[model samples]
Target chain A: DAGITQSPRHKVTETGTPVTLRCHQTENHRYMYWYRQDPGHGLRLIHYSYGVKDTDKGEVSDGYSVSRSKTEDFLLTLESATSSQTSVYFCAISRSGTTNNEQFFGPGTRLTVL
Target chain B: DQQVKQNSPSLSVQEGRISILNCDYTNSMFDYFLWYKKYPAEGPTFLISISSIKDKNEDGRFTVFLNKSAKHLSLHIVPSQPGDSAVYFCAALRAQPSRTGANNLFFGTGTRLTVIP
Candidate 1:
């Protein structure tokens, strides 16, 4: 509802293969984030970008990499996929990091690594 | 180490009854708290949020209570309906902006609420 969309809503791939998920937003928010949801772990932050070409790692940034070349597109790539990387990935955007830090999330990408 | 914790993994309540979901945090610097609801196959949607400055914040049937001294927070849904059944996640973030130029949120494991009709 926040003008966010994630491509490839679902995918299944074998281990050791390269995979990438894309998050696109139309709101032109200043912040973008990538998160993964797993059982018992909830949603863990993978990476986030505050502005174009500015990015940082999150709590669970291991085994993953992200790039933000433009304001609307953020990409999450798993160089060599592993079984542990399989999870529902979500992208979020917010106008700022002040008191009103409410983040709007995209539909999500369900990636399965065999 | 989990900074935020949601001890309950699941909860059940009859429709029209009040449903309470609890969350706890270990960090004292966390000044903001939020609740998110997620339905199956969909991304989480923001439900409510509270700042440490206040003990309670209410919006419609959803109310979030924060106990600073106890490092705890709870969400109350009054007159719950079947549509309320979903996975609820509690998240926390510090008020200050991180040096990395992004403020990240730590989330709880989530509680599945089943509102029986």
Candidate 2:
């Protein structure tokens, strides 16, 4: 609802292949994030960027990489797709990545790996 | 370790009643908490948030109460409507000011709330 859109709302890939998901926002927010949601696991942060060219890993960053070269876009890449990595990927943004900032999420991309 | 935990996997509430969802966090470094509502085919949306400085925060029919000593937080919704039925996720924000890293949110296994009319 925050002018955020995640491309390829649904995707199917095979194991060992690389997959990239795109998150685009018209909010022009300074902070962007990527998270994965799974059954029983809820949602876990994968990566976040405070600004363009500034990105860092999150708790589940082992198989993921991210890049943010602009304020409106953040991309999440799966280096090598695995069945265990299949999940619903969500992108979020906030005016500021501060403690009090509330995040707005995009319609998730459901990725399936076979 | 699961820093944030939601004990209840699901909760059933009746219409015109109050629905209370609870969450607990083990990390003391967390300073901000938020509740999000998600539907079947959509991403989680921001419902409300509370900072560590206050004990309670209210927005219309929704209220969030925080207890620092026990590291517990609860979200209260009055007059639960049928549309209120969805999965609720509680998250805690961890800030690291020393580094250029952005703050990250730790989430709990969401609780699915069903409102019966």
Candidate 3:
């Protein structure tokens, strides 16, 4: 297992509230990713960071944003939570300079919007 | 459009039997493929992978077969155990140097494998 941890293993919030999920890695990997897992949809990438202050949108980046100001932390925020945003969010990290390298994952954060 | 797809939503196999999970992709630019297994309430873990230049790669009980011409890949687990029950995802990436920061993976919908003992 990689030294990756995601805060707030589970959360419940109102539809219009703001929600922030944090991912921290001790390995100091250069690549980090955020994904949401839903039934029938499997896992969809929301955003990813290649380095500090360098991030890009993924297939399902709409309504979600990410920030990586330091090497060890990656944060995913929902500006205004929505019911459709309720899902299992996962954080993954992979070392730089390797395309086939494996990604280590955090336990995951399950969010529910009411 | 879904570039990577796992058509089977779920699969069942008996203990000690062979469990075969299938995946397909429509993009020809994808040159590297990987399989990940996920247990409920936990994150997905890397299982196996195959490069486009290779047809098959194996590790322990897991084996991944890639058919570039057909744009398909399959994961095989022999002597499947109850612990093997989980949702498996297939992912693909376009070949690019890591320094370029262009490595983004497209994932499949996943197939839930249930091994009945």
Candidate 4:
């Protein structure tokens, strides 16, 4: 409800191919994040960008890369897809500089790598 | 190692009854804690949060309690409803802001709450 949108609501791709997911926000929040959700792991942070051209790895950053060239968009890319990477990906945004800044999430993108 | 942990994988509660969800964390420096609820096929939504400075924070039918000494927290929903059925995640954030720290969050495995009518 925070004006966040994720492209390719659902995607199916084969292994050994490249995949990219897009997250767009209209709220103009200063912070954006990419996360993957698994059955037992819940939602694990993959990467986050605090500002344009500034990004950092999260707990489960392996095999994932992110780019934020503009304020409204953040992209997550998998160089070579694997079945293990199949999961629901979520994009979240938050306004920085506040003690209780809350993160808002998009509907989510379900990716299936076979 | 998981800094934040939610032991229960799923919980079932009867409609109109109180639902209690539990979470634990090992980090002492985490000053802020939050709870997010996610429905099937959707992303998580912010539920409620509590700061380390306070022992309890309440909003509507949802209440969050933080126990810094025990490194634990819990969420209570009064008269739970079927709409409240969803997977809930407990998250913690370090208060300090540094170059290495980007206000990123550490999350738990999440607890699935099912309110049965």
Candidate 5:
């Protein structure tokens, strides 16, 4: 397994409150990604970082934001949590962001906004 | 719209039987395809992949077949076992320039497979 860990494996937050999920990796990978998984939607990328301080929006980036200040840490924040944002958030890392490289995932964080 | 589509929501197969999962895509630009397996409450793990230039790729009991003309792909698991029961996701990659790292991939709705013991 890859040296990846997600903080707050499970969380319950009130609607309109701020929430941040953390992804920490020890592999020193260059690429880090944040994804949310929902029924019938599979896993949709919210944001990804190619390097420190470099990030890009993904398919479902509307209600989420991300930051990568260091090579080992990537954070996902829900500015103001909403009930619709309830889902499993996953953090992934890859040695390189190429078709030939496979991304490894960390244990997901399940967030519930009530 | 979903660029990758997995029509089946769930499937059941007897142990030792061949299990086939199908996926389709609408984008012609997709040049790479991959499958990931996920157990409940855990993150998905990469299973197998096939490039657009190849029709098939196999590793152990897993085989991936791609048909570019039909924009379809299928995963075959021979002698399926109960351990193989999990949700499978199909993902597609559109190759982009190397500088930008076009690793952004489109995923389909997953299909849950239950291998009966």
Candidate 6:
């Protein structure tokens, strides 16, 4: 389980509204990531954080932003929701700093933008 | 372009049989590979992984075979059970100069495996 939890396991919102999904971890892992899983795309990284206040963009980072102000928490925000943005979002953590390091995933949050 | 690809979208197998899921990648820089299994409405869980240095890695009834020369990899599940009927994803990792040791992964589209009871 990786001591991970995601808020609003399911959500529905209209386009143009801002939404934030929170990922919390009980373990103090140094690396945290946010990814969106879609049918054809599989899982694409949206953003990741290496340490508190340090974050970077991922492959499909458009329209999304992330913040990790604390070690155990990483938040993913959609600046303006779009129907295309509707997908299951996943949060993962790794102890190491590398991108290919073994990762543990949270349950996931399904967001629907109408 | 998709760096990692799972050509098969779905595969069916009978209980107690063997199931093979194939994955291919285009990036020769990728040295580490991983497999993850996901049930509907849940997050993917790490299954097994193989480094480019080895051709095979085994844990219990699951094994991953890597063919670096062909830029291919396969996950084999022996004695497939109905419980093993889930989506399997193949991922590859290469360190980018931008992020020293950070291991961001490139994932395949995934294959849905169904083990008929």
Top-scoring candidate (lDDT): 1
Regions more than 4 Å wrong, model 5 = B97-99
lDDT of 3 by residue, A1-114 (tens): 788999999999999999999999998889899999888777888998988999988889999999999999999999999999999999998886477776768999999999
Better of 2 and 5 by TM-score: 5
Candidates' chain B TM-scores in the order shown: 0.98, 0.96, 0.95, 0.96, 0.96, 0.96
lDDT (0-100) at residue A83 of candidate 6? 100
List, residue by residue over A1-114, the lDDT tens digit for candidate 1: 899999999999999999999999998888999999999899999999989889999989999999999999999999999999989999999878675578889999999999
C-alpha-based local distance difference test score of model 3: 0.91
Could you tell me the C-alpha RMSD of candidate 5 in Å? Answer: 1.0
- Give one digit per residue, the lDDT tens place, for model 2 in A17-94: 999999999978888889999888889989989888888888799999999888888999998999999899999987
* Per-model i-RMS: 1.3, 1.7, 1.7, 1.9, 1.4, 2.1
Q: Write the per-residue lDDT of candidate 6 for residues A1-114, one digit (tens) a residue.
A: 689999989999999999999999998998888999999999999998888998989899999998888998999999999999999999998888654578889999999999
Name the better of 3 and 5 by lDDT: 5
Given the true complex, what DockQ would model 5 score?
A: 0.71
**C-alpha DockQ of every model:** 0.74, 0.71, 0.64, 0.63, 0.71, 0.65
Q: Please give, for residues B66-90, the per-residue lDDT of candidate 5 as tens digits.
A: 9999999999999899999999999
Residue-wise lDDT of candidate 4 within A6-110, one digit each (tens)?
999999999999999999999888889999988877778899998898899888998999999999999999999999999999999987746577888999999
| B116 Cα displacement, candidate 6 (Å) | 0.6
**Model 1: per-residue Cα lDDT over B18-99, one tens digit each:** 9999999999989999999999989999999999999999999999999999999999999899999999999998878798
Any residue pairs clashing in model 1, and if so which?
none
**What is the fraction of true interface contacts found in candidate 5?**
0.63
Q: How do the residues B17-89 of candidate 6 rate in per-residue lDDT, one tens digit apiece?
A: 9999999999999899999999998889999999898999999999999999999999999989999999999
User: Which of 2 and 6 is ahead in TM-score?
Assistant: 6
Each candidate's number of clashing pairs is 0, 0, 0, 0, 0, 8
Least accurate stretch of 10 residues (summed lDDT) in model 5 chain B? B95-104
lDDT of 5 by residue, A40-73 (tens): 8988989999999999989899988899999999
